[model samples]
Target: MPPLVKLVLIVVIVIAAVVIWGRVMGRRDPDREIVGLTDAVRAKVSREISAGHKINAIKIYREATGAPLADAKRAVDHWFVPGQGPGVRDAAASYTAGRLTDEGRARISELILAGRREDAMALYAEATGAGSAEAQAIIRTWDTSQHY
Candidate 1:
C-alpha cells in the first residue's frame, strides 16, 4: 500500500474509534456526572449563590454536570452553607428557580433572527440557567414565523 493510503486508513480507524467511544460515553448516567463535579465548580456555585446570582450558580452547576435546572437548583440549595464565604447568606434561599420566561423566549427569538443561534442559546442558558439539552430544545421549538 502507498504511504498516502496508509495515512488515510489510519485516519479512518481513529475517527471510527472516537465515534464509538463517544457513543458509549454518551449514555445517560446522572449520578456519574454529578459525582465528577470538581471542588472548584462547587466553590464557584457557592460563590455565585452568595452573590445573589442564584441563576448564575445554577448555570455553572448545569454546565459542569449537564444536570437539569431543577437538579442544579436543588444541589445548590442543599450543598452550600451561608457565611462560610463571599455572598453567602440566608437570603440565597429566596432566589427564584431558573426558567425561560416569555420575555426570555422573545429575546432568544430576536437573537436567532439576527442569525446568532449560538448566542441565543448562550443567552437563554445564562438567563434561565437551563441545561444544555433544555436550551437546545427551546431553540429547536422556536417559532421562526414570529421573527418575520
Candidate 2:
C-alpha cells in the first residue's frame, strides 16, 4: 500500500474509534445519577418532616444525604432562636451529658424528662456555646429517640 494511503487509513480508524467511544459515553446522562434506596427513602422521610429554621432543615437534609458528621454545634448556632430556640436546651443537654460521663445518658435523660423544658433548654444553650460534643450527643440521641 502507498504510504499516504496507509496514513489516511490509520487516521480514519482513529477517528472511528473516537466516534464510537463518544457515542457510548454520550448516552449516559449526568443528571440521571442515582441515590441508594435507603438514601432515597431517608430523603423522602426528611422531606415529610421539614423544619421551620434553616439549621434544623439542614440537619434533616444532611441526615437524609447521609452526612458524615452531624456537627450539632454548627446546626445549633445557625438555628434561629426566637428569644431562645430549641438549640439552647439542646446545648445544655449536650453539655450536661458530655461533662458528666459518670452521670451518663440517664442524667441527661433525667434532665430532658424532668418536665422542666425551659431549664433543660437553657442548659443546652450554655453547653452548645461551650462546644461540648457530649451536649450535642445528648441532643442528637434525644432527638433520635423522639423521632424514632
Candidate 3:
C-alpha cells in the first residue's frame, strides 16, 4: 500500500474508534455525573428551560459532560421536578405564574424581530401557559414595558 493511503486509513480508523467510544459513553447514566453540579450551573440550566430552550439546556448539559442527548434531556428534566434543587423551585414558580423570564422575553423579541410572529406566539403560549386565543391576544397586545 502507498504511504499516503496507509496514513489516510489509519486516520479513518482512529476517527471511527473515537466516535464509537463517544456513543457508548454517551449512553450511560448522565444524571449520576450531572447530579452534583453546582447551583450556578443548575441555575443557568433552569433559566434556559424557563426561556423555552429546553433543548438548548440539554445541549448545554451535554456539552458540559459529553452526555448523549437522551441522557442530557433526562438530567435536565429531573432538574424541573420539585425538591430537586432551589433553582428548580424558582424556575417552577416562574413557570406556574405564567410569567416569562428575561431570557424568554428576549427570545420572543428575536422571533418577532425576525418576522416570525407565529413562532413567537407559540413560544409565548408555552412559556406563559396561555390558551391559543389568550396567547394571540397577549401577543397582539404585548406591552414590552410591562414586566412579563
Candidate 4:
C-alpha cells in the first residue's frame, strides 16, 4: 500500500479502537453510579440497613459526600424504596430557594434527567434539604400537580 494510504488506514483503525474501548470500559450510566458513595460507603449503608438503621441515612450520606445536588438525588432514589421517582423539578425549586443561580439549577436538572423519577426525587430531596428553596418549590409543584 502507498505510505499515505497506510497512514490513513492506521489512523482510522486507531480511532475505531478508541471509540470501542471507551464504550466498553467507560461509565455507561452516570445516574446509576450513586454519586459520592464509594463502595466503602455503600457497604456501610448496607451494614446499617442490616443492623436496622434508618434507610434514610443513605440519603444523608449522599448529602454529606458533597456530590452535586442532582447527583445526590439520583443516588438516593436508586437506593430508596417506593420509588417516588426523581423529583428534579423539586430540587430545582430548592436550589432556587437557596438562591442558586440559573446555572446551578440547570446543572441539577441535567443530573436528574440522567436517570429517572426515583433517582431524581432523591436528589431533589437532598438538594432542598441542603437548602435549595427552588428545589423545594419544585417538589411542591410536583406534589400539587399530581403528575409526578
> Which candidate number would show the highest TM-score if scored against the true structure?
3
Q: Give the range where candidate 2 is weakest over 10 consecutive residues by summed lDDT.
A: 139-148
State in Å the error of residue 148, model 2.
Answer: 16
lDDT of 1 by residue, 36-97 (tens): 46646765676686677888988888778877666778987775444443432231222244
Clashing residue pairs, backbone N/CA/C < 3 A, model 1: 50-87
Off by over 4 Å in 2: 1-106, 130-141, 144-148
Best by lDDT: 3
What is the C-alpha local distance difference test score of candidate 4?
0.49
How do these models rank on lDDT, best leading? 3, 1, 4, 2
lDDT for residue 77 in candidate 2, whole number 0-100 = 43
Measured on C-alpha atoms, candidate 3 has an lDDT of 0.65
Which has the better TM-score: candidate 1, or candidate 4?
1
113 Cα displacement, candidate 2 (Å): 1.3
lDDT of 2 by residue, 1-148 (tens): 9999999999999999999897555433455433432523433333333333545545454444433234433543453322233433333344455643433434445666666544554465453453443344334334323321
Winner on TM-score (2 vs 4): 2
In candidate 1 the C-alpha lDDT for residue 23 amounts to: 62
Candidate 4: list runs displaced more than 4 Å.
27-148
Enumerate clash totals for all models, in the order shown.
1, 8, 0, 31
